[model samples]
Target: MQLTILRSQLLSGLEKVGRAVNSRSTLPVLAHVFLEACDNRLSFFATDLETGIVMPVSAEVKTPGRTTVPAGPFTEYAKTLPTQAELTLTLKDGKLTVKSGASKASFATGDPGDYPPRPTLAEADHTFTLLPGVLKDLLRQTLPVTATDEARAILTGVQFDAAPAQLTLRAADGFRACVAQAGYESLPLAPFQAVVTARSLREVLRLLDGTHPEAVQIIADQQARVAFLLAEGVIVFAQTLAGEYPDVDQVVPKTATTEAVLSVEAFIRACKQMRVAADKPREALGRLDLQNSGANAVKVTAEGEILTASETTLTGDVTVTGQSMQIALNLAFVLDMLEVIKTSHVRLKANAPNTPVVLTPEGVPGLLYVIMPMVGH
Candidate 1:
């Protein structure tokens, strides 16, 4: 392979595709980025066998060829070169050489044929288009609720459901669930659903340059075991998780016995202060008391690891008629929902202290979160 490209262009391509490189994989080729110079452009391709990316950058191609080089070292070296400096890359006899102003380096190259081929959605059943901002907003709502626990692979991914009128993103751990939706002009085909790993979508989020509001193409091909996201300069092949996602609509509560409306800002502030006393990162327990007293005060209390305790009352509006209610819940989960909700006011509702608590933004109709309450001592 032989190509001359600006440092900025080269570095950008490498950084984008490098997210798929698994340096510790048993197959050494998985650590390398495959380079193909053709059609007056150089494409960087990398994959960990599960997720993959291809980022094509503008370059002057002298001899069209292909080679693979260590992604980590090549990217690090590119960072040291002067910005916009012209770089020449050539591969021959199993070595790829890099040359720039007053600097030169060579890396061992592997046969491009050994690298995994880019995924194709030949069996795709549904294809849709969305703006970068729309995808990012939908992702932000569900990514936080995805589980890190690998044992339940299904829970570690977000469910993508495409209906006739909307696209919904849903994710859940055992403790909490998040559901967000956006309107999409769906195709005339049947409804489709797929589950994509949160880790893969996170990389897609990073590559989406917000400045360019280009439409992103989404191809859902669960039968082929992959989904393709095509953007301006990059294409992402997201490995689809096997099995069906839980019905999030059933998980959300249908009616609330007690409900209260509170300022998102004030409630989050009080919860953060209460968490400081508990000192538990994941299971910080807090008791929330929502009373429809004439004063409309919501009380929050937390017990510390020691004998200390913290309690604070926040002023809020009680628009619904209900008996006074108290529920013990994980403040960490509550705070996670609060931080992601973009509305000024949040409505908290529950059927009972032990049942699932549904939280939704006051004016937002499509987004909802359901958090299971903590068991009382």
Candidate 2:
């Protein structure tokens, strides 16, 4: 492979595809990025078996060929080069040469033919189009709830279900659920529904964000991989988890026995204060007391006396006994949820002391958050 490209362009392309390069893998080839120079453009490709990415950059292709180089070292070296310098890549024998300005480097090359084939979906059987911004917004809202555990493979992926004129993305990690919906002009022909890994989806979104594609083409086949063609410069491949996502709709309660409307900022601050106390305990324990005393206000108290060195007093009257619980939840999770909620006033509801607590915006209809109550001592 021979090509001459601006250093900035080359580095950007490498960084874009680097998201899929496996940092630690048994297969050496998975750690390399495939560089292909053809038709006046150089394309960089990387895959970690489960996820793959391709990014193309403008270059002067003197000879059309392909070579695979270690993705990590190559990216690191390119990033250090001068931005305005011209990068010249050449492949001879089993080695690849990278030259720019006064710096020069050589690396071993692997056969491009051995790289894993990019999966393809039937163009006729499955297809859908979405505005990039809208799709990104939906992912940002829902992807956080996806499980990271490999044992619950289905829960690790985002569930995309389309019907009629609506498309919904749903994700859950047993304890919490998030769902986002958008409208489509027409129903997708094949009803392309699948559970795609959240990690893969997040990587794809990152690539898309870098490119700013106007629209994204999604293609999925039954029992096969899914492909997202963002533009001429980018493509993403992800394997679908082959299991049914749990019935999330059923898990969300339809009625509430106790509901309170309070400021999101206030609730977040109270949670943060409680977290300071919760984190100091060997067995983290924090309590939230909610009571509706009047028409316009509901009381909220977060207390953890076990971890505090001194007694803390509230300036206001107490309306309910401290609803104490010995739950060890990562405080970061609570903070993440608070940041994503899109309203100032949040309505919280709970059916029973042991039941899950649901949070929604005061006037918004679609967004909902359900957090399971901790088993109290």
Candidate 3:
């Protein structure tokens, strides 16, 4: 392979695809990035068997060829070169040479044929288009709820379900669940669902660039894999988890006995102030008390073993139904939900102190979080 690509462009392509290359792979080829120079562009590909990515960057291709090299060292070296410098890459014998300005490096090359075949999806299957902002929001809201336990593989991914007019993202660990919905312009041929790993979704966000190309195409091939096509050249692919996701609609509470409206900032501040005390205990449970202080006001108090915090900031129009109650919940769980809410006011509802608390933005629809209460001593 011979190519003269801009240092910045080469570094960008390498960084984009390097997310799929696992540092600890039993197969050494899996840790290498596949490089192909063709059609006036240099393409980079990497995969860890479960997830893969392909990114193309503009390059001056002198001789079209393909090779593989270690992704980590190559990217580290490229990052040090001047962005204005032109990077010249050439493959001879079994080694690849990289030269830019005064710096030069060589790496052992592997046969590109040894790399795993790139994943592709059929065009006639379930497909849809989502705005980049919508896709990012959906993933951000639900990813935190995904389970870290690998034993329950289904819970480690966010459930992507598409209906006629809307697409929903749902994720749950054992103690908490999050659901977010966004409207899509193009609906799939039929209703489809897939469980995509949280780790892959994070990389997909990075590929979105957060600026250019406002729309993203999603292809869900039940027979193959889930593909997120960003712009026209970049693709992020992930294997769907085998098994059925839990019925999130049924798991979320439909009614509440006590409800209160509070400022997202104020409540979060109270939680942080009390986190020092809450973090000391092995259980890490923070006690919260909600009471109807007066007209259109609800007092929120967070209590820990050694520290206590109370906030009475008449936030919006606070309404409390049923009796006053105190609930113990994971401080980390509550803080996670608050950070992603991005709203002025949030509503908290629960049937009892032992039941799960449902949190939703005051005016946002199709976005809610349910956190199970901790057992208090």
Candidate 2 per-residue lDDT, tens place, 138-195, comes to 7877888888888888999999887657788888888778767786533577676788
Clashes of each: 0, 0, 0
The list of candidate 3 runs beyond 4 A from truth reads: 209-211, 280-283, 293-317
Q: Order the candidate numbers by lDDT, best to worst.
A: 1, 3, 2
Off by over 4 Å in 2: 122-124, 185-187, 280-286, 295-299, 302-333
Candidates 1 and 2, the one with greater lDDT: 1
* lDDT to native, each model: 0.84, 0.74, 0.83
Question: Compared with the true structure, what per-residue lDDT tens digits does model 3 show for residues 1-377?
Answer: 79999998998888889889987988999989999999889999999988899999999999999999999999998888986999899999989999987888999989989989887675538889988888888887898899989989999999998888899999999899998999996777788888998888988887776336668889887555889989748999988888989988787888887888788887777666656666463345666677755555554445554565444344455566666777877878888888987788889898888888999998899999999898763
Per-residue alpha-carbon lDDT of candidate 1 for residues 319-339, written as tens digits (9 for 90 to 100): 545767899989989998899
Instruction: Give the better candidate number (2 or 3) by lDDT.
Output: 3
What is the alpha-carbon lDDT of model 1 when measured against the actual structure?
Answer: 0.84
Candidate 1 ranges with C-alpha deviation above 4 Å:
185-189, 209-211, 226-230, 316-320
Q: Kindly report which residue pairs in candidate 2 clash with one another.
A: none
The TM-score measured for candidate 2 stands at 0.88
Which one wins by TM-score: 2 or 3? 3
Per-residue error (Å), model 3, residue 222: 3.9
